[model samples]
Target: MPYEPLPDLATLSLAEIAALNDARKLPPVAQWNPQTSGDSLMTIRADGRWFHDGGEIRRPAMIRAFAGLLRREGDGRYWLVTPVEKQSIKVEDAAFIATDVAAQDGALAFKLNTDEIIVAGPDHPLVARGTAELPAIYLAVRNGCEARINRSTWLQLVELADADLTAASQGVRFALVPA
Candidate 1:
């Protein structure tokens, strides 16, 4: 798919943001139930770099294609699934990084490193981990995958938060601080 610039979230309503998010058509990895399983020899590093067999995958298109097929099982293992095979891939941290964020009309819109946009709401909730002083906030992406809200983006959320350190979006409020 060709790259398109993201619209200004600040100028868009929640409904518009949701439309922009669902515009992209992803693969049906969730519905694929392959009987073959093995290691993919791929790793997503903590800093969001993807490596395959000791070599870095420098192509953005390849990364995006692979990310579309990523799925996380109930056992906490990451896999790249296809119709014929499902291969486990190691993830050092979250599968993707929340690179940018914007507060839309009563919504929190996030931009992932893979150029995917998602709105934080009931279906895609924000989860806080670690400690209050050093929190790790994550946003649910898709198919049980999540994007770790990077430091700068997390700080943006902090600035948007109320006195209680809670950010509200789509009638759901999330605590910025770990509890």
Candidate 2:
């Protein structure tokens, strides 16, 4: 599906902001406690794309909705949980892609493929994962979920970091670290 950027939240009405946030919020999957009945017929690709059965899930909004419903159990397993049922889903790597970034006053914020936004702060730490030679950078999403930072975004982040250097950031090397 063709993509359109989300409208600026600052310009939106209070009701509009509430509506957008409500749509992004998923049901309490963690508290549902549904029996693990079956595996989800879905796989998240290494490049942060999702597929079901076989074909790609091309709708960003649909993908965003599903992402909100995803959960990770204590045993390092993934599931899509609703009030009625819980089902497993395969993740080749991370489940999300950090597609866009914005920087303000030395702080970095990200926009996901699903249109959700997060700042790379305490709750949303940015780190590089994967091998040293070819790292997969990530920004934390809600819970324990981490979104893979794409190459272009990573480059932009580097540029921002360089441009907004501070004494604390001086010599604070940002390198590929395990996620």
Candidate 3:
């Protein structure tokens, strides 16, 4: 007898296979945030997972007031992934020191020249360090001071970088920063 080929999965009707696929890849229902517009953000209740615009996932982490940056994908979508860990500090905190770059000896140093922050923690003295031009928020603990990076600010930075880099490098910048 001749071997038989399997049926094409794509050929199946939507109603016929929707239930089976949903069961296998079923994510928990999410609690929608009224503050966010459009279908960009989703909060899954099953595991407290947060899905951002560009399929970026965030867990239960304390996001800070002024850390990270946001970038837009070509498909009219935005991604919020921070280079540093998801903790941020207010710009006006007493412990916060704005400097050019972060150093091990410096508890909290902000690189005004580069627009970055360097922070230290108890367990790890050089806990977090990153530039202020990314699309995510961060939090750092240093000198008994807790710092937070704002998500909104991060998003704005991402948008700005995208435009400037695009024009200057003529698409070379896109290679440097991933979508």
Over 1-179, each residue of candidate 1 has an lDDT whose tens digit, in order, gives 47776766566777777687677789999999999999999999989999999999999889998999999999999999999999999999999999888887788999888978888989989999999889999999999999999999999888999999999878999988888
Candidate 3, superposed: residue stretches over 4 Å from native: 1-116, 119-136, 151-153, 156-179
Scored by Cα lDDT, where does model 3 land?
0.28
Q: How close is candidate 1 to the true structure, as a TM-score?
A: 0.94
Comparison by TM-score, 1 against 2, better one: 1
Which lDDT values do the candidates have, in the order given? 0.91, 0.70, 0.28
The TM-scores, one per candidate, come to: 0.94, 0.76, 0.17
Better of 1 and 3 by TM-score: 1
Give the candidate number with the greatest lDDT: 1
Comparison by lDDT, 1 against 2, better one: 1
TM for candidate 3 is 0.17
For model 3, residues 47-100, the per-residue Cα lDDT tens digits are 222333435343222222121222222343332333332222112222222222
Q: How much lDDT does candidate 2 score? A: 0.70
Q: Which stretches of candidate 1 lie over 4 Å from their true place?
A: 7-13
Lowest lDDT 10-residue stretch of candidate 1: 1-10
Clash pairs of candidate 1?
A: none
